[model samples]
Target chain A: MKVLAPIAAHEELEMLAAAGAEELYCGIVPREWLERYTGAVWLNRRSPKGGSLDSYAELKRLVDDAHKLHLPVFITLNSPYYTAEQIPLVLELAHKLSDEIGVDALIVTDINLLMRLSQEKLACELHVSSVAAVLNTEAIRFLLNFGPSRIILPRSVTLAEIATITRDVGQQVEIEVFMLNDGCAFEEGFCSTTHHHTVGAFCTSLSEMDTQFEWAGKSFTTRRQNWLRRNLTDYREWVWYVNGNGCGVTPKGLPYGPCGLCAVPDLQRMGVASLKIVGREASPFKKLASVKMVRDIVNRTRAGVPKLHVIERAKQLRESPEHCAAGFMCYYKVDESA
Target chain B: MEWSLHIGGAHELASELWLSRFVEADRSQLTQPWSELAGRLLVTEFGDIRFTHCAFGNEFCEHLIPSVSALQTALTAAQQQQLSFTLLTPYVSNEGIAALRPLFERLAGNGGGEVVFNDWGVLNLLRRDFPTLIPIQGRLLNKSLRDPRVTPMYATAPAPSSALNVLQRSNLDCESYAALLTGLGVQTVETDNLPQGNDLSFAQYGLRIATYAPFGFISTSRICMAAGLHYRKADKFQPGAPCRHECQTHLLEYSYTNSPFGNRDQKFFLKGNSYFYAHTESMLHALFAQIRAGQIARLTWQPRLPMTVAH
Candidate 1:
């Protein structure tokens, strides 16, 4: 499997490529779009401030530099959906990125945008974004009608579901899974909440709110309610911890968040094509360390290491045995019974 | 205009009060014109709202999909009450799809009905195998911003008008989006009574709109907190874990004291796997005005807080 890492600026190219990134993806919001829609309407799922490149020239430079290292570059246009007026601007950007700047593919989420891209017959490959929420084989087949060359499964999917999907449609299209960083409390595709820095994310802000539990239209006993509240508070804290503790890195400079290294062999056996490292808005140092961490596991899996040993190596690399033991940082829930 | 009563189970269809109100409205509708039906609107409460159709099934969690026998029972009740039936479906995995195949077949075999698909896969299955069933795009797929926490931001923020417009609009605002649904054999689309309000101008695209009132969902997840309430810390927050439907017996309510948007105290309800906020009276009044103006074709009334009710 290939390592797909996030790229933000032209300067991060060499470090990420040297760290063993086989593919790169980024989001760019051109000046014209920013002037009209403002940062409030994001071109992608991330905030437009640090999340995307500001100009076409910057994107072209990044694409050219990555191509020199034999790394394929993909651009994200993966907002849940675009309005009628916004669709034309998005289509024009897709064309310029694919036809003019020489990007390898466009990672898109909206169904209407996909249909328009397929009908227009853009020169680049179309990789459906995980925001499109392809959870089952039938969804993959449905999206296949529009002709996406790759499908990124949502983070909410289990390993068993991933195996079933790849088994059914792996031959038809390449499959990608989230490997590290950035986990959502809800299914990102179905979540319609805004991610603006001003209001913050709805899910994260939930921790600050007060909670109460009622059963059958009556409040639970004080003791049970207290337990439920504590459970909720602990769960939210764990989710926050897994999401890089507000996108923080450890003292050793290793990125800390959700990790899926233990599932490398299972994914490889399932014919998965790529392992994606999320966080385009992250610093270059964090991005490089994340890529290196994933590259180590991919290499171990390729070297015919025993699955149990690979899992053990993955746990050791995280440097947080307690978190691993608690299973708070697992992206894929590995079934021990299996 | 038409009104539909949405419920999660077959037992809701057994309520004589609900059946009597719907049957009386159906009888009055046989003689009254469609335009005059708006005058008979009584927005007192869910019990008073007259409906012409019944929508049954879960729209957020596949684990809550009704059994085939339960579906049959609901269908029979709808038929006996002389109302149309619409089956609501959620986003599902392969296992969920397998479980729903028989129910879809049963619905299709029983002289066909409307199916509200929250997932594209379910829509694909309907178009492929259950051709007899008409598909209605559910609100989960509408992709509209329904966050109540940010409701005050739209009015107080220094953002441009275009940005706010994007937030207020739904996918139906795009002509190609509506056209795509129409091409998929969908003549109707569903939406929530958004806190920031809605723009029903998409009705011009030859697509009818159904707006759910009183309770609009903000977000949902497979990592069910309700399902794991009794599990240990190490076993908590597990996605796709089996449960005894604990959500049916409990509801979590949240109140935010210091909202970044404004001084208004924001509140939401967490039932099962989703979080929802009750729509304000002003929003409901606007919805009624839109319905009276012929923009919204249907109103799906929910008597309960979450669409999923306790037995």
Candidate 2:
């Protein structure tokens, strides 16, 4: 399996690559990250030297090392917006990712932007991202037609469904499933508006702390389909002080808490081209330990059997500093669904 | 009977020729290139052809749309005089819709042609803004398929694949698609590059995001997604230049499909499996065929058939 090591820093990338990492996925660089952060004074886009550091240079260095080691890289492109003002910049970066930097694929979320890339720009592989809400066959079929090189499967699937999906789709296109640490309540494809606040340019991920989404009157929210029946075309089901009613999205099925309940066996049966372990939030030691656990299971899966033991693994990883356990989201699923 | 043919004349071919300019810097290639492409388009008698007013990406929102007079000039000079063509714009943003009024006057200056829009807000907005111009909500607002889960992600031994479940499940998606059409009073739902077997037009009415795949033969398409697009509009010129390629992606690949091989597979879907968008287009052809032929096998929910009766 192509093991995608989710690293927090460039230094960690080398460590993971040495740990048999085949691919890497990372967040926006600090320099770039500071600029778009939504809050006026904090993230100055006009900053002359970019940010406090030229992280892109560091990023390029990491990319060079990965390329030398024969590891592919994917940059995260998940964000929320309507007009698609992101295309030109996206295209330019993709060009660099291919021509100079050489990142293997881009983990993207938008369709209109993706279509233009496939048609007009970019020579790199388009790996389907987790945020695209591609959960079902029709959704998969819809994305498949676009000719993505691989699909990063949603975190909501069970071992059985992944097997069925793998059986139907095949391993050639490459499937990157989240093997450890991270699962959300929202449908992976349709719901994102999180992580950044629009109206301002400084509400970066760091600033937007202590926030969680929940329904306004979920109990009162009608269970009926298409809440806007009287005005069928109108998607304004709920009046929002900010955006439209989830902008055609409903609040149902959003898990209320932790992710990672079915982590163990899930890693074993997914059969994706890569078994990715989401890091970032986890402690460094836990990050290393989590990678080791998943890598071991994946290596064993080649023997035609799957490995799992979420409860024990979670217990074992508790002593480490980066303690967001692999099954961190697991308990939350049960609590919310219950 | 031969299925509906989307034949492009000299005018329809111009958009592609304009796009081809970016690929090849040589000015000569753009000038007479379609002489060959148009010949290829005309001999194949088409039922309808489409000429969108805007470039496919969001960048075109700020630019001035080429005037209808310019479009008319192109049409007049084009080879095929008898062939019919139409208009489709994905979103029809406020800036674009305003530019469209004058452009449409030019497209219809020759006494007649149709203009169909894709965005829902644009449809409602246009009904208020451009009451005279014909509108067709691009599949963006009224999708060909939508997957609303009623059962667990995984079912007991042997159930329909999640890909097929949206089709089998409560037909909620079909109902939504048909109903929206009835309410909006649209002319047609635009779809391209559909699945081989199922036709969006006839298979069953459903709405979902579909992507375009110009290469490789894929009948199944991107049937699943990983997650959803989570946007945070912070800035365009943030400290570090935006990753040009990251901006190109309409939605996050990891966030959406389980099968985002878009760059490799060259496919995608907007709300759902944009990867298998070709299937959605194919489905549109089937629906158009059955609807035009006046035979809808399963009108489980036709929204409002009476309203759709063109005659």
Best by TM-score: 1
Inter-residue clash pairs, candidate 1: none
In DockQ terms, which candidate is top? 1
Give lDDT tens digits, candidate 2, residues A175-285.
667655543333334321122122111111112222111112112234322231222112111011011112111133211222232343454444567777664544455
- Assess each model's interface with DockQ, reporting 2 decimals per model: 0.46, 0.02
Tens digit per residue, CA lDDT, model 1, A113-137: 9998999888899999999888889
Off by over 4 Å in 2: A29-54, A81-84, A197-270, A281-283, A303-338, B1-311
lDDT for each residue of candidate 1 in B1-311, tens digit (9 for 90 to 100): 77788766666667553423442331112112211232223334223555678888889888888888888888988888788898888888888898789989999899999999988899999999999999999999998777788754774567588877887787778888888999999999999988777877788899988877556889988878878778887777877777778777667777876576554466677888888876655666677778768888887766554436322
Q: Which stretches of candidate 1 lie over 4 Å from their true place?
A: A336-338, B15-48, B155-159, B307-311
Chain A only: TM-score per candidate: 0.97, 0.65
Under CAPRI classification, how is model 1 graded? acceptable
Q: Write the per-residue lDDT of candidate 2 for residues B123-168, one digit (tens) a residue.
A: 5544564556566434333221222111111122243343333222
lDDT at position A195, candidate 2: 25
